[model samples]
Target: MNIDRDARLEKPVITANMTPLQWANTEKYWTLYKKESRISSESDRTTHSLTCCDQELRDQLFSIHDDIFEMNDVNMLKRIKNMAVKSESVIVAQVNLVRSRQNPEEPIRSYYARLKGQAVICVYTVTKK
Candidate 1:
């Protein structure tokens, strides 16, 4: 799945102010792109992952991290994910999820899928008692 060619896999430019849901969507698309493209090599995956972001984000990554160039795809993703998620943003995501509702004309399956997608933004940490 070429990011440019596929609408579902289009590259999302990660900005500092982007909402948690937006970041989740971006990550979801990136994962889909990786799966569909079958990029197996760590080097190739890292290259593609780095290129998927906009130049601004790339510049920010470079500026913030000294070893970005030396990082693999998983580490790069972790870095980006850390930048994207925040405590306040998690509350916002929860609010958005709570506000989400199906349109009157929307099918149940589509509505359910949409809710599921929105739920991704509301990350919950599970702890065993």
Candidate 2:
């Protein structure tokens, strides 16, 4: 997917449900995703992680993955999960949306972790498919 000169290039299909802020957050992160996709071409470790986890774990991971960096000081996977669990939010549905760069068939899952009063989202990676 050479996206250098094609301004009208069709964005890949994805199944994701995100709020305005979450969508904006993803917009910022997409720059990193695009760079990684271009440099590695096919090295989507995070995407693979999301794809491989069982639906249950994938749902759990998605909620934490999306806003981990913002929620926590460090990006430790374990700590991120712990942070999510501590929030007491029920893991919600998986979103159906494609990464802007490498559009995979399994749209990355976007989980909405809604606690007693609020919901925060995150996109879980499929470390490998």
Candidate 3:
């Protein structure tokens, strides 16, 4: 397996995902490879499938790739539609908490400021589409 000493050195080639790549090889991993012969690890399955993704998809995925183990695609999709991707979920949840609160005893200016900050956070988190 150690061919480095005898192998010829060549220039490395960098390939970019210029074209759209769909997840078309699921059958190979799910049915063929792991059907009975071997059990594939979570990391192996994730990396293998990601290799077929386009650049845009890969970049979007990279942010939460490490947290892939805890990711729920259904919930993630809903968050994305709301423009609350990743850390923005905190702001959204906070806004809901504030909105549910009854009138609190506070100065008029401070109360308005709090509401305004929450408004801004909500506006940005909501996706137009």
Candidate 4:
């Protein structure tokens, strides 16, 4: 069978569920959202990026407000933020521990060993990059 394809058919169709007002606002929000500051920390960046998706769009995306995907995303973001804050505290503690002087009664070998271990842990666990 031979059929003539209308050129208009090549264009995208607006989804029936989304209204014109919602679409316009979403487009405007997206443009403004992209101009926001870029974060250096991975966790901060993730939080910032996720927040850019406006609530209106989110409501349109998931029929249920308590959708599993939404819940998981929120939980993951919270975990990332917590990890970043905790890692910062850990790094500071390790630095202080490494800097403290050994007691007069402590052996020089033991002091060096403790410092080396702390240094290794800091280097492996709290990398900023």
* TM of each candidate vs. truth: 0.65, 0.22, 0.25, 0.26
lDDT of 3: 0.42
Clashes of 4: 0
The residue pairs in collision within model 4 are none
For model 3, residues 67-122, the per-residue Cα lDDT tens digits are 64454534433322222222345456466746654366787786676565555545
- lDDT for residue 123 in candidate 1, whole number 0-100: 81
Model 1 Cα lDDT, one tens digit per residue, 1-129: 235544544444565655666777777777777777767899888788878666777788888999987889989888876765553566786898899888999999999988877777678667899
Model 4: residues with Cα > 4 Å off, grouped in runs: 1-90, 124-129
Task: Report model 2's TM-score to 2 decimal places.
Answer: 0.22
Local error of candidate 2 at residue 81 (angstroms) = 7.9
Clash count, candidate 3:
0
What's the residue-level lDDT of 78 in candidate 2? Answer: 39
Candidate 3 lDDT at 67 equals: 69
Q: Identify the runs in model 2 with alpha carbons over 4 angstroms from their true place.
A: 1-43, 68-129
> What value of lDDT does candidate 1 attain over all alpha carbons?
0.75
lDDT of 4 at 21: 32
How many clashing pairs in candidate 2? 23
